[model samples]
Target: MTERARLAVVGAGPAGLAAAIAASARGVHVTVIDSGADAGGQFYRQPADDLGARRPQALHHQWHTWERLRDGLRAHIAAGRITHLRDHHVWLVQRHLNGFTVHALLGPEQERPAEVLADAVLLATGGHEKVLPFPGWTLPGVVTAGGAQAMLKGALVLPGRIAVVAGTGPLLLPVATGLAAAGLEVAALVESADPKAFLRHGRAFAAQPAKLAEGAQYAAALLRHRVRTYARHTVVEAHGGTAHGGTADGDTAHGGEVRGGQARGGEVRGGERLEAVTVAALDADGRVRPGTERRIACDTLAVGHGMLPHTDLAETLGCRLDGLDVRVDDEQRTDVAGVWAAGETTGIGGAALSLAEGHIAGRSIAARLAGTEPDPRGWAAAARSRTRLRRFFAAVDAAYAPPARWTELITDETVVCRCEEVTGGAIREAVDELGAGDVRTVKLLTRAGMGWCQGRMCAAAVAGLAGCALAPSRRPFARPVPLGVLARAGEATGEPEDD
Candidate 1:
């Protein structure tokens, strides 16, 4: 009898979970690693069991799908076909002669090192929010739109009583509606992108009636809560009560016309949290209109500009990237052998796309490991769904893109990199005065991307501010590793034979 081929699936999200289930069912010895304590990723985030709260499914939309995935994972785990390793934060994947070695940090402290050796690796690391900074965004009451949703789903906590959800993405719909449903006062939903753009991709969008219905349900929820929506508008700045050098009052502070008979502008009360946000209308070219500003009083501001695919691990493995996402072939295989990428790492399509891609990859891996060719017909249904979902999301991406001149709203003094406190002025000096033409050069001239986040939060903004195209920064490791882990990698033994 031959030994089963070992597979290491990174991330316990929808993609990773689906891959493990499919592959393991095909007789592969599968191990699933994830940073979260639970199986569900951000999309199916589950509240703590100790919360004693009934009807946790009420917080989620795709209850049936999540249930199936969860049950399948449990069955596989119990049958001894799969091993689940939660709280494993994978930091690096080292290519050996025959296979790969996945090095991860264990637990919340992240000091202990853990390693898993496998014949093949499946990367399902998800995406992160793209945040475009504005003045006063660093205030205490400000949070990412996804961050707000995560808090509500994971901990049942509200960001604040009065919230303003402002962003240019489909994520804003759920965040606003969720907050309103939780009895929080959702002041407004400020969307920078024009809804009219959806007309251009009507054919592609009409192909997915389920997606349209999902969006309509969210719209109805917003209407039920009476959440004021401002399409073709964006938040120019968040005003906190703390005194910074400038006065919060006056037309200049608010930027444009006040709507709904709200106060034009006023001084932020001292020692309080976020008092309000200044939102302005956008022109046809996606530039902000000068005199259409409105001040909406709110205690919290939830903002995000869409998502960026996490390509750090793929880049380290010499995997090709298509635009911002890791590129993979029809079988979900990367250009590099034995490495397959799925989910947001491949592209920012949602959980459904991730699941379909993952299942295809799993079947392909299983067949290839058994020294056989995978018939495309076996996974034709998944492939078809993947195609349709990708097209649907492509339309969504086009319709919800950030405003064209969003950077114009960023004041020279506004801090762009919150990690290193690198301001816009410093970034401009690196480009204008120091001849730093690209994001890398700008990073060298001013320690902007050298912060704790390693440029994850600021890379897009830096590229835009420097007038350069965004490119992947090939990292040696996906996350920061302890010096001990680095030293130990050299001393490890067991060199497997070449494939």
Candidate 2:
């Protein structure tokens, strides 16, 4: 058995990195397991080292903060206080009598199983984008707002040259401006949420001036690039066609190594590439205004409704959840013993809030492992920042909710579940024709959520079409594991569990 208390952090984004550094500083051994090739999670996704990206900071929002975290993590790893496990997809974390057993799959194929035993687990699993389906949503050139950002940051590639960024969130601001700054002609930023609604949460908005300034900066960038902004408008459908002369994306694998080049638009695959998107103004009721439909020519549609917390692992551990997010106390402790959650897993607050929560949780974990009660005053500064930032983002989330009546626009033929090719009409029939009263029933009837993604992409859309609350399916495993891996996961794997 190990003498130093070992903690497992199940992400490497802003939250997990912060927690790992904090815990390591407090004489705790930390293992950060993430699926990315590097430490920075999606928000601070690092370019592959071989690419020699000199200006990676240009693509990130908080470059200085990221630099500090990255440096600290490197220092800790060098000192052997923390172990960084990259490309390990954690499928399930099982609570054991000793502590916890984290079951993960190694490499991209995810055929090989790996296990890590720890005294506690900090879940910073982050979140995923929610893209509501419309006609032609399954087209090749369309990706989530974060997905577009990921392609840019991770692979050093853009989605397309001419793009319409249609989404309703603070995320859209960065994405639209980032694309424009990267030389993509942003045709329009179509936002479904009305700016007028922001006034409702004035006090919450007033709490954080920095966040407001951030939004202002994004708005200014949009203007400098001459990107047209259509307030209270939404994408009705995407149009696809054959395109010639697509920009070659950077650094596709060559001889098992990433080739180096400047970031560029991704090469369009042979299928029909995105050519345009039909946008329409939304009425007071958030329904599309009939006569306001306009077709904007673009090669890509970077669209998203908002975000949903990744709660599969939490559910598997039987952690209490408040609606869609995992429930946590002030120190970011989950209801389950020895489990702490921060970042988007707790809620959809931005990176700063995640950092604060992560710091607090890490400190708490260290104190608990040492068999001592944590002093609230220890993390007082972070707690204050957390409270203020949470208020600020609550207002932002309120103002940026997807168009209230967006479900009304989804045509019967629209593919709601891209994995299963389940259409909106099939979901409606499961609800209206059959006696399906919930998303689970609808899934069973139509196999909408039974695909490889296991309902991650379609749960919200399926719930909306069936007029049911988007409840957690409480999946047994966070992700699908191969039968070979699951058959004897505990007996043999990578290194023996450090129990």
Pick the TM-score winner.
Answer: 2
What would the per-residue lDDT of candidate 1 be over residues 173-201, giving only the tens digit for each residue? 99999877776789999998887899999
Candidate 2 lDDT by residue in tens digits, 1-499: 1122389999999999999999899999999999889988878988888867767787788889999999999999999999988889999887766788788888989877888888899999999999888898888778888888787777667667688999788889889988877767799999988878898888898778888798789989999999999999999889888765354453232222323434344565676867889999998988888999999998778998898899888998889999999999988999999999999999999899889999999999999999999999999999999999888888888888787898887889999988898998888899999979898998899999899999999999998888888987789898789998787766522433332
Output the lDDT of residue 230, model 2: 96
List residue ranges in candidate 1 displaced over 4 A.
Answer: 1-5, 242-272, 494-499
- Model 1 TM-score is 0.92
| RMSD after Cα superposition, model 1 | 6.8
RMSD of each: 6.8, 3.8
- Which ranges in model 2 have alpha carbons more than 4 Å from their true place? 1-5, 243-270, 492-499
Error of 2 at 33 (Å): 0.7
Q: What's model 2's TM-score? A: 0.94
Kindly state the number of residue pairs that clash in model 2: 0
Q: For candidate 1, give the lDDT.
A: 0.84
